[model samples]
Every structure is written in C-alpha cells, then in structure tokens.
Target: MKATDRTPADLLRSALSEDPARPLVTFYDDETGERVELSVATFANWVAKTANLLQGEMSAEPGERVALLLPAHWQTAVWLLACSSVGVVADVGGDPAAADHVVAGPGRFEDGLACSGERIALSLAPLGRRFPTPPAGYADYAVEVPSQGDRFAPYAPVDPEECALIVAGAAYTGAEVVEQARADAPGLDLTGPGSRILSALPYDTWDGLAAGLYAPLAAGGSVVLCRNAGLLDDDALARRIESERVTATAR
Candidate 1:
C-alpha cells in the first residue's frame, strides 16, 4: 500500500494483520545495555488494550490530550499507536503544564507532576525488573491492564484530512507544519519484509516523527532508534548500517 493511501491507524492494522510474529520494535537500553523485542501481534494487542483502558477506564474523551513523557523506546511506539486507535490526541511533550493527562517514568519529573481529580499515572519500572504490583497512587503499565486477548476493536473510519498528530517543531517556530513528507520523499519503498531503518534523532522532535517514526511506518519498515552515532561519528553509523543491513535512513 502507498503511504498516502492510508492513515496511521490503517497502516498499523495492515501491519498487525500481515505477520503476527514479525518484530515490530527492538528496544535497546543504553543505561543497562539490554534488549527487548515486541512482536507485531503482541504490540498490536497491547495498543488495543491500552486504548480500551484509556477510553473506558480512564474516561479519556475523544480528542482529549494525553501527554506522554516517555523515552525513545518500544513503549513509546505502543502508546502512540494506542492513542491513535482510540482517537485521543497523544501529546508528546516535555512541558507538563500544557497537558491534560501525563504518563511518566520514575524520576523527579514524574513525581513532581501534580495529580488533581481522577488523574491516572502510567508508570514504568526499572529496566529488566520483574513485574511489580501497582502502588496506591500509580498504575503499573504491564500489570494493571488486561491483555486484549485474541479480539481487537474494529478500526473506526477516519477522515484523511483530519489532524492525526501534533508533533513539536524542530528548533523553534510559531507555526506548526503538517505536510506529509513521507509521501513526498523520492525513491522510498516499503514493500519488502527485511526493510530496515536507523534513526539517531529524538522522538519528540518533528524530524524524528517524520523520519524516524512516520516514514518507516508509511513504508512498512522496521526502525532502530539509536542514542548517538558514537565517538567515531560516521564510522559508528556505518558500522551500525552494515551490521543491521539498513536499507534506508534520513539524515
């Protein structure tokens, strides 16, 4: 399917149905040096379950802003997909003041955010830690939500002209640009199963969303998010490209 032929949710549905066992995301933690893999089927189920929880349990109205302060990892992708599934506007923001709801990790920023009324906190545990019980205030993301099981909610018809994401501008700009650069990039093909991508950009930034996330998804390609190009710069990037056999990348 062409990038312009479908919405984000449409592409996700197609991907989930294509190969359930295919690896959708490969997460690597720089702090502990560990790798976690989430299959396309499993990730799709999680997105549906989380979307249900967000819409049913949390009572998050459609078009409501749910701020995500997540790192560039597999969970971020799942959350974005979940929000897209439920029609909730997932605000990937650093500033907590502008968000209606917030999902954060264990840190000063997570603890500092004030929770008023029936606010929900989706917290992540330390890397490689066994599933922990949900505390009085916070909800453990892995444990609290039940798996969507074999069934998934049917995809709601979406208007192609509607806004899907509100990605932050790169550098600093007052006006937000929402063009489909993925459709415009020349020589971009996502028809093969082994297609791979390497991205060193931050997820919250516009370039990262367009290149790292949207482009690959539009092309049905697997993405690898890296921290940096390493000390040797081009040499490290080249090594990664050679090792992963990346077919395409955005500089």
Candidate 2:
C-alpha cells in the first residue's frame, strides 16, 4: 500500500525536507499589481510563527474554531495551515459568534466585529507588513507574527481524524483533506517537486482550497495564487504564467 499522508502539516514536512529553498507559494494581486514569492523554508517559518501566534498570542486551543475571513491570498493559506498545526478547526465564512477567534482582511474588518471573540486583522499588504497604524480592536497579525519564535513545536501532536476545515455545507478532517488532495493531484497533472500550478480560484469553496492550497502542497508542488484575477488582461495573465514558471492553471 502507498504511504498515506496523515495531515496537512505532513505535506509541509515533506516539502521542507525535500527542498527548503524551493518556491512553495507565489501570490499575486492583479488589482494592486502586487507579487510575492516564498520558498519552502520561508513559508514554513511563517507557518511556525503564525502557529505560535495562534497558540500563544491568541490562546487558541485544540478543537477551538476560528472563522477565516480573508481571501485566496497567501496569508490566508498560512492561516489555514497554522490552525491545522494547532488543531484548530478553520471555518471558512462560518458563523463568527460561534468561533473562538475571527481572522479578517481589512475589507471585512468592520463586518468581522459582528462575531464576539478575539479579532486578528491582516492589512494584506505586500510582504504581510503591519498596518502603518494598527486597527483599534484587533491584533495586527503582521506585527505579532514576526515576534513569535521561528521554530514551532505544537503543544501536542494533532490528531489526523479530527475536524480541520469547515466550509459552507461540509467539514473535512485533516486526514480527509490531505487524502483528497493527494488523490486529486494526479488528475490535475500535479505530482512531484517540479509542478507549479497557477490558480485563479477563490478560496471560499472546497474546490478552490483543493486546487490552490492543499493539492500543490500535497504533491510537493508550488502554487501561484491569484486574487482579483478577473481584472487582469490576457497579456498580464500570460506574463504571470511565464515569469512564475507556472506549469498548470486552474482557469
């Protein structure tokens, strides 16, 4: 039998061990004309720090729910993995009042307040920089994440069969997500370190999460994530594909 990848973090370990310097996630904002690329080790560092922030700064515990209020950007992906690392269930667009925390982008900062709990805001700026001025009622992820330790050892090992992702109508365990992504990769022609998938899919849905987030990580491939891709012209898209060495696109 083929070895089963147990959890979302398991893929990160393989990617990090295989090629720490390889590009793991490349993010683009067509509307803002912003681009950011992160290698495996760099991405892992961000994950570690964010994981620590979730467990330490936010006081998030295993089995707690966190509503994800961001877009399909790279930072959002980091949060998904961070929650998984700490065994926090990531609720994408789920009810906020029912959650222990809410992570929102600037666009929805006010809307996010409707949910009563710890609020973390992302300026969503290039390089995940801090807001020049912090939001009054929210913790600035950019500022706090950097202060966290680079190395992260989860308080305890996460159970693979536990709920990890919550979406519109369904919830998936960490093992289910990993297994499905591993199964879906070959159909997408993604298999190994050389794969580079440029996905324009919005992350609010399970399909988008699979194509743009989990699949690449599972296959040891990289993702070129695009938000506001509809605004980009054909020439812009072509250039992105070429410059980023994108081997596939979920157009």
Candidate 3:
C-alpha cells in the first residue's frame, strides 16, 4: 500500500495509477468452466459505476449499511470497492432487515426482500447476464449499473477511522482493514510484486477476504479466484496453476 493509501479505494486507485492494463482479478468458476480476467482499470471502472449507482440512485449516505449477500465472485469484489468508494459500510452476509440497502445474488433474492431499503439483485451468471425474469421489488444490477456514470466522487470524504466493513460479526474501519490486509499478505505468500495467488476461500470471513481480494491488492499483486474449486480434478487444477502463473495457494 502506498503512504497515501488509507481506504480500500485508495489501494485500488494506486493500482490503477501504477498499471491500468495489468490484470488485477482473474476469476474461474470450475463448475461451469468459466473464466474472466479484469484489469485494474476495468475493475476500477466497474467500481466507479457501481459507486455511482449506490450513491446517486440508492442515496446511500456515509456510514449507511449495505448488506451484501453474494459470494467470492468478481462482481462481489467490485461491490466491496464500490461501497468503500462511496463511504458506505459493506456488511457481508449481514441482516437484510437492518440494512439501508441490499445487494444479493440470485439464490438470496427472497432473503434480501426483508430489507425495506432499496435492493439490487445480481444473477451471478457468466458474463453478468441478467435474469430472464427480474425478481420482484429489486433493481437488476446488470441492468441498472451499466447506466450509471463512469466516474464517481463521493459527496463527503470517507473517514478512514469510520467503520467500513462488517464480516463475520466483526466491524473493521477502512484503515484497520488495510493494515490487516497488509499484514496478511506475507503469510499468504504474497510478499513480492506481481504475486499471483489462487484462492478458493469463501468471502464470509476475514481470512477468505484477505486471501481472495485484499491481500493481493495490498501486496501489489493479482489474484486468481476460484469458485466451486472442488469440481476441478487435480490435473486440471495443475494446468490452471501453470497457465495462470500462480505463485501461492490459499484454501
């Protein structure tokens, strides 16, 4: 992380400034044989559009809670940074009824309806395809997010000391999250620049979050996130590690 980096958004910005074309997130769904690669600039653009949608359309105020009922996909990573960019607290697997806004995957669509606040739903399909029938009382994220502005600027500066993430019932401020991610990098074997760590951990806990997303960013590296990794045979996994140039593994 740079000296000026405090919030997770800052880490993203630093990455973008350093190398816009460098791959930041490479996601693989072993069950579906789907693979996607997103560069730093591409990911930041998604975050910007999502942030705009949250701040302008949802009217998410600083410190407001956004329940994220998603998994360890690339879109989930986008929403995490988007929440940070807009200064809202991202509550992973949080109580929907208590949130000011909700973003849920297809499987959790019914559960997210408990939130009275604005709700968004992701199909989580390959290539971010929209659902054939939109879920009732929820904005389709693939439909709405595309129309949002490409640039995002928060109305107020995000306080690094303010709570930014709630995972597994523990709240962490933006600064603390960054510090913890930085600390996790070495142990996860992400000490060198351009380190490519492949992770199959879910995003419900800090360890999963660190290994899959934050630690790679903090270490100026990229990640190969695998979902449904158990479905891949040993030979296929070995080929993937070699093809993806993976330097570390986090399970």
lDDT of 3 by residue, 174-196 (tens): 99989999989999999867899
Per-model TM-score, in order, reads 0.76, 0.95, 0.99
The collision pairs in model 2 are none
- Ranking of all candidate structures by their lDDT, best first: 3, 2, 1
Worst 10 residues of 1 by lDDT: 170-179
Q: For residue 179, what is the lDDT in candidate 2?
A: 90
Clashes of 3: 0
Q: Give me the candidate number with maximum lDDT.
A: 3
What's model 1's overall lDDT? 0.59
CA lDDT of every candidate: 0.59, 0.88, 0.95
User: For residues 14-112, could you state the per-residue lDDT of candidate 1 as single tens digits?
Assistant: 777677687666555545555566677777777878777776666666556667777666677777777666666666764556655666655524442
Choose 1 or 3, whichever is better by TM-score.
Answer: 3
For model 3, what is the alpha-carbon lDDT of residue 209? 96
Q: Which parts of model 2 are misplaced by more than 4 Å?
A: 1-4
List per-candidate RMSD values in Å: 4.5, 1.6, 0.7
Give residue 110's lDDT in candidate 2 (0 to 100): 76
Pairwise lDDT winner, candidates 1 and 3: 3
